[model samples]
Target: MESNSSNPYKDCLVNEERRLIDERTNVGTVEKKKIAIHMAQSNSDNHTKELDLGTKTPKPIQPILSAYPCTGLGKDRRCFQPQWYKSFTWIEYSITRNAIFCFPCRNFPTQPQKGYLFVIGYQKFRKVKEFLTAHGETNGHATNVILWNHFKQSLIEGTIKEKFVALTKSEIMPPGNAHYCSPPLQNQMLSAAGNIILKYIASEIREAGYFDVMADDTRDVSSYEQFCICVRYVDKTNTPKEFFISFEKVVDLNAESLTKTLISTLNNNSINAICVAQAYDGASVMKGHLSGVQEKYRKNHKMAIYAHCYAHKLNLVLISACKYLPQSRKTNIGENRASWRNFCQNHHSSENNDHIRSYKIPIDTLNIYL
Candidate 1:
């Protein structure tokens, strides 16, 4: 018999496998269609039932519980509860007892007597009313005024003077070693505290071996000149730490004035120089060649070097670019002349309507002069 070179059995097996796969694929398609039809029928039935009942499906309910623990206060004062629950409990108690009073007189006893009027002055009453009005706590200014006046009259005659005496005593002998003083007096205390903090910061800086200084001035809403001085140094952990050593009030912001202010503030706080590096705003008075703050400091301290502020350099560059460049023209001579003309025209315009004007220049033109 001749040797069978072709694999007939293998070819037959491959044909059978292809046929089985096609049959299985058709079966899967049919099963999916049946499942889709069944789902549609079920949904239709549910919709019909809802229509007949004339009721919408109820939404899944969400829990209205909080994550924080709820607790009750006992005779022991040390027991703590969730902050929200405690606040709610106090509010409920106040409402039930009718103990809630205007913020200014909340601590006073209920049904204030005739002599209690002296404790709260007319100015304070007015201030409280104003505060309430500003904060939208009460409506009708006239009603607030009437209620405040009635409450005022209920106070005792000598109570105001007594309260003042109590306040003075509190200041002189604050409870628990904490300070108690009026805001103005508190400001004076803060100034003294700031001086102490500065001394501590300076001492820390000195111990650190060497440091750089960053100084700047800014105006507040009231246009008060405030100067900020900080020491930049790397701590033992090799991390950069900037300690704001002082915030001094300055009379003027000129270069000489600022330099004088800086020296005076540092000297008062006992911050001695050790290879000083001054960083300031790029204003002429601060960074200028002649009589600038850095120049003034250089005269006094030979080791003082002005660190050129990158931000200031960028700002100066942008300002110069805008001033010398004209609309649509970038060539230095043409742009400058155009800008000058536009500025002159805008300055002379009667209605200041020059903003609506535009200059024409070729878009394809490129000038290296700029």
Candidate 2:
């Protein structure tokens, strides 16, 4: 009931004897050369789903006299022999077409020129070896070789997901000194490696039984509040170590929010159970007994002892001393103070005034003992 006028398989004669060698199956003879090659590659790839071992060196296929008919005469009436097939790895002889083809060029042809043997049959037997050698030395052939090697090496390294390629000869040997990876690509690779290292460090810290957590929040130049967390613990050798683990953004700087963020980070690293102590700056929200971060944390973990930073206490004391101390005023203290006051009141001379002016302290500095 099908009309022959619109038949898709009209020109493709499907031979039942040998299906693989039919003209429809040959990628080189088909109008859809690209599609045929893609389909053939996909089918082959589906079968051999294993790591590419870059060592797929070609072993010359042995051709028999009956199977590969070479009795056809060339331009010079010379008959092709089995010795010609043994000479090259890329050369593939066709018995039906009486032609020779380049295997590598046919499979992975590069740009500009895909080589004459890739498109047309090479039937001239007089100088066949010369043409083969010339085709092997082209830029396209070298590029294809590099591509094949890179694909195989990537599969073996288990970095097929990363899609990292091996450095080419031009990149390795150079005045260039740099590889082909862009800045963004390099950052991505480094980020992956950094994540792996962080996981390892986290695991090591979790193995230690007890540790102390130190946290502080600061506003950066961009006005973003970032809270930094550090852990101090002893290793298997009993060596004390402190490690800065994480920096988290603080959307809300209240006791509840900061406690939640810190607890979340600890839980993520699997170290929430082993915390023995907590340290933070002497902010009212952190040190307040009723509704402080320390108090909130103790609701979950009671054994964690809270400690205010001594350096922060010292800074507050210094600020108080500077604020209360008078710079230019002198109070009466001992006999020295009375003596100095008597001398100043009695001797109202210009020389005494010059002497007092020489020792007078500036308003900016605090003279605590004066």
Error at 8, model 1, angstroms: 99
Per-prediction TM-score, please?
A: 0.38, 0.39
RMSD of each: 30.9, 27.0
In candidate 2, position 347 carries an lDDT of 44
Residue pairs that clash (backbone atoms under 3 angstroms), model 1: 115-155, 115-156, 115-157, 116-155, 116-156, 117-155, 117-156, 118-160, 119-160
What C-alpha lDDT values do all the predictions have? 0.49, 0.60
Give per-residue CA lDDT, model 2, range 57-147, as digits (tens).
Answer: 3421334565443321212344456677657765665443355666556555566433335543454454678877887797777786676
Per-prediction backbone clash count: 9, 0
